[model samples]
Structures are given as C-alpha cells and as structure tokens.
Target: MTAAASDINFCFPVRELESERVKLTPFIPDLHADLYFQGSAAYPELYDFIPWEAFTDTSDFVKKVIEGCVRPDTGIALYAVIDKTPTGTNPSKPTSANFAGIMGYTNTSPANLSTEISYALILPPFQRTHVTTNAIGLLLQYALDSPPHGLGLRRVQWKANRLNTKSINAVQRLGFKLEAILRYDRIFVGSKTNAANGERERAGDPRPGTVGTDTALLALCWDDWESERARVLQAMDRRS
Candidate 1:
C-alpha cells in the first residue's frame, strides 16, 4: 500500500503526532494575539526571512491565514508547533511556534502524484532546532501515507530567495538536493530596475525589471527524505 493509503488519520482536523520534543497543532484564532505580540517581540530577526510586507495589523494577518486554510485554489495547510515545556509552574506554556510555517502543496497540477511543498516560515527562536526538521518530517509522512499519492510523490520541493541562506542550509541539512538555479526568475528591491529604466520600481509593483535574480529550487525524493531522516535521528541519538 502507498503511504497515503496507510495514513488515513493524517488528514486535516487531525492533530499531527507531537514530535518527541514538540507538539504540532492546527492554527487557532487566539494564537494571533500571542504570536503577533510575543512572536514579533521575541523573534524580531524573523522579519528579514519571510515576506510580511502586507501585514498591517494582527487581525489582518490572522484573517488572511484563516482564509488560506478555507480557500480552495490558493489555500494552505497550516500547523502551530508547540515546544514541550518541562513540568514546572507553567508546563502548559508554549515556548515556540512558527508563526507562518504554513506547509502544504500548491498546484497539484500533475494529478495525484505530484505536488509542490510551498511556503513555510519559522519564528526566530525555533531556528537551528529540531522543530522544523521534525515538523516537515511529519508533513512528509502525512503526504506519503495518504492514498494514491503515497510514495508516488516524485518530489518534495523547496523554493526560496537565493539570499535566504538559513533556509537553504536548513533544507540542505534535511537532505534536499540543490537543483538548478533559474537566472533572473525573481525580482528584488536592490535590483528592481531594468537596463532601460534608470529608476528602480517599488518592491511590490510589477515592472519590466528582471532583478537578474532567481529563486533557488531544491528538491527531495522519497529516498532523499528517508536518508535525511535517518541521519537526523542518528545525530539526535548521538547527542543524547
């Protein structure tokens, strides 16, 4: 049986199995308040990583995420990573969660077998930790365990701005093979001017400027993921 067929309980409304050190829960409404306030305060460094040019208010960002979960075409599957706290005065307190580490496929254009691993964000505190690695492992498990698409998924893709070295390193460590770089596929603020136009266009607006920059695409096949997982687990065991 395919991974999908064996993993029926992996669907939405399902609280994904908590990692040995973390819990993966579906995003909730009130998290907006905590995440917007505490997250921004705690992990200000994250502003440089993910796109947040459009979030003006807490409610606006929350609403946008909610709409994505409910929408069909551009909607996404989301999860909040709750770090395990030791038994203490506030054992129930959540230490960290990826504010926008939204994981899900987009443009399953090739029917059941092919899907792209799209957007994900990790708040600063969670970086360099096992949270993202295991969270993604869970996501991959869900995808592979589900029917029709199980194991048949030819690729699990990760695309990011070439400047995002942290993301690049993390995905690489997770065993994703670095693929080709598409030149000038993405435009950026620094190089937003076309050769003909002397002035640089605004960041969000579409212009003829090529930026001469491209998104770096990385990919992991089932074998790659399994190998990576084994390596990660082995490293964790050695550390323990």
Candidate 2:
C-alpha cells in the first residue's frame, strides 16, 4: 500500500470524546456488522450516492476503519458514536460502539481552500441525541484548530438532495452558512460525477451508478465554525 500522503497529517486517528451521555470513538472492527446494518437501514435512500456494499462484511468494515485510520489521501476519517448508558442508576444498560459515520475531504477546490463534509448513522436508540451535535462540533473544531493540517482549511461544506430538508436544517442549526443551490450541478444514480473533480472513474469502480442532479449546498466556514463551537461547548458546560 502507498504510504499515507498529503492528508496523513490532517487526521486525528482513534480520537475519543465524551458527550454528556455518549462516547465517541474511532471505529472498531467488532462494531462493523452492527454499523453496516444500522447505516444501511438508517438511510436506504442515500444508497444511490454512497457505496454501502463495502461494509457488508465484518472484515470489510474493519478494513475500512483501519484504512481510514492509517491511510491518507484516499480513506475518509471515521468515528463511531456509542451511547454511555449509566450503570450507576437503577438499571444498567449495555454500552457498545453503535454506528459509524465519517468526515473528511474529497478534494479541495482550487478557487478556495474549501472542503466537503459528510456525517451519518445514529442507529436506533442513538437517534436525535446530542452525539450528532457533539461529533459535528468535534469535526469543525478539528478542522479549524491551528497550523499544519488546519492551516489550509477555509470552508466546510455539505451537499444533499433538493428534498433533503432534514439534512439542510441539521447543518443550518449547527450554523453552516447556506451558500447556493446550483441547478443540476450533481449527477446521482448514473456515471457522471460532478464533485470538485469532473466525472472520473470511482476509486474502486469503473462503472458506478450515476447519482444524478442535486441542488442544495450548505456550508460552514472557519468564522461560522468558531462561533458555533463556542455556542455548543458553552451549552454543554451549562448542562453539566
């Protein structure tokens, strides 16, 4: 395998964090099966755009996690969010790594130092919890931290289907500035990819499904990220 390249310095491998009632950790091999099932079941509609088959097997998912942790350039950094059920209470609830989601750059556009951001999968009991917010905060914080890996970061962005209001609101609530809705700018469910790079062969697939046309592109920049992280952390402090 190629030695981790330009992006190796950009990631924090195996990061761990506590968010009120949950623990966010790097994706572990054992949790792959559950994570795969949870992610696929949680968002079937997103299949057209994402490659879910790669995670069907425990080994494959484990490999993916390993790659994300050790490989640069290619693999997106992944984090699994686990609920911390308090055993100190009346009844003890099982605590385990729940689902896997990722955040990283696909490509940085030349016009500006902007990068795309994507995160998902909060299976079953984990849905609608503070974990998502906390994880997102961590992602933004990591992106804007300081020199070295963080120096080139100017914008963090999210793009989803025109009808994906839930995604739109979620990013907006986190204070991402909605930039533009480029008409027919994406190609989903087909072979033409319109990401920062024009249509090209996928990393592994020569003939991937065409994910045609999407409109909304929500974005958060270093300025907005600073304010949002402060608000989120302050709110967390108040709750504690």
Candidate 3:
C-alpha cells in the first residue's frame, strides 16, 4: 500500500544530517554571512551556474533565504554544507567546522512520494572530494529509508542544464540514470550576455535575443535504489 503524504513525517525546517567528511544543517538567517562569503570568495566560476549570484550581499542573502529557501511552502529545504574535518596540526584541539557549500531538496512532492534534489553548490576545494558523494548518499538514504528512518520516498529526481556535463557526469557516477532531455526547458533572464556567440546567433526568429537552455533529467527510483543502495553505501563507506 502506498503511504499517504500525511503518513510520512517530512523533515521540516531541515534537520541536521552528518557524514564522515561534512555536516548538513538547516539553513538559517544567521548563516547569511557564511554562505555568502564561501560562495563568493572561493571561486568566481560559481556565478556561472548559480542563478543567485546577485545575492552575494548579506542583506540579499538573508532576504532570499527567508523568502525562498526557508519558507515552509516553497518545498525547498536548504542546508549549509559544513566541512567537519580537523584543520590545524593539533589533533586534540577542537576546530570549528567551515561552511563548504549549499545543497538541498526542491520541488518536493510528498503526495507522490517524490522529490527533486537541487541547488548543489560545493566549493572548488571541496570539489572532487568525497564531500558531495557522501552528501548525496546521505540525502538518498533519508529520502528512501522507510518510516521511522526517512521519508520513504518512491522517487528522487535530478535535473541539470544539458550543457552542464560536469553535473551530468557526477550524477551518473552516483547512480542516477539519464531520463530525457527537456528541450528549451528554461528561459534564463539576461542569459544573452552569458550565451556564446553561436548560441546568440542561433536564437533566430521567434525569440531573437532570448537565451534558452535544455534540461537533462535523471532519476533514481525506489526499485533502482533498492538494488543499488548496498553498492552505493559501500562506496561511500570506503570514502568516509
């Protein structure tokens, strides 16, 4: 029998999730400075993919966090990814965790027992590390585990810009299968400036100067998770 939305206790206000290398904490307004600084200072390339580049300022980040990320109805639960590894040479000394990036679930649909993973933003240094792999594994575990452990979701979806080969490759490695390409799926406002010359030239006729991007859809359904979960956890355990 399919569990109704009411039957599942969705983690509200985002709960804390931990892995060996990192910690995921619910987004709070007080994190505005940390999030802004980590995102802006580490790499300029972050602005290329993330649409919220304009929110580098603490005030804007706070406003956006309140209005978009933390809002209960938005169906987007944000988490601040923090690095838990010890930094200084002193092994016994306690070191504070550093904010590594942001990631979360979006377009959550409890009624359908499905959710979309979105807003993966790992800092450049944290890239290629097990941080992302473990983050994803943890999220998958939470979304797929049965009641008393997780949301018991039937499906978890991942969508990336078709041009984002890095993102596609990452998900593919993590066990999400390619589903389909959504043609001209999203219209990014002011994308013209960022679009390549060829892309701009090809924007002919109907929407001359507009820039649209195709979306690549991928998913790991319940059955797939059941089959792959052990292998995935084994890989994560090795990394952890």
RMSD (CA, Å), each prediction: 6.8, 7.6, 5.9
Query: Among all windows of ten consecutive residues in candidate 2, which has the lowest summed lDDT?
Result: 89-98
lDDT of 3 at 188: 61
TM-score of every model versus the real structure: 0.67, 0.62, 0.81
Give the 10-residue window scoring lowest on summed lDDT in candidate 1: 1-10
Which candidate should be chosen as best, given lDDT against the real structure? 3
- Residue lDDT tens for model 2, 1-240: 122233243333424555565555544444434555545554544443343333455556545645554344432554555555435531122233434343434444535666566645455344465656666666666565565534446787877655567667877877877788776465444442432224344676643554435568888887776667677565434433
Model 3, residue pairs in steric clash: none
Arrange candidates by lDDT, highest first: which order?
3, 2, 1
Model 1 error, position 133 (Å): 1.9
Worst 10 residues of 3 by lDDT: 88-97
The TM-score of predicted model 3 comes to: 0.81
Name the better of 2 and 3 by TM-score: 3
Residue by residue across 72-175, what tens digits does model 1's lDDT show? Answer: 34324445655553344221344433342334455443444545555465555655666667666666655544344344465677786666677788778767
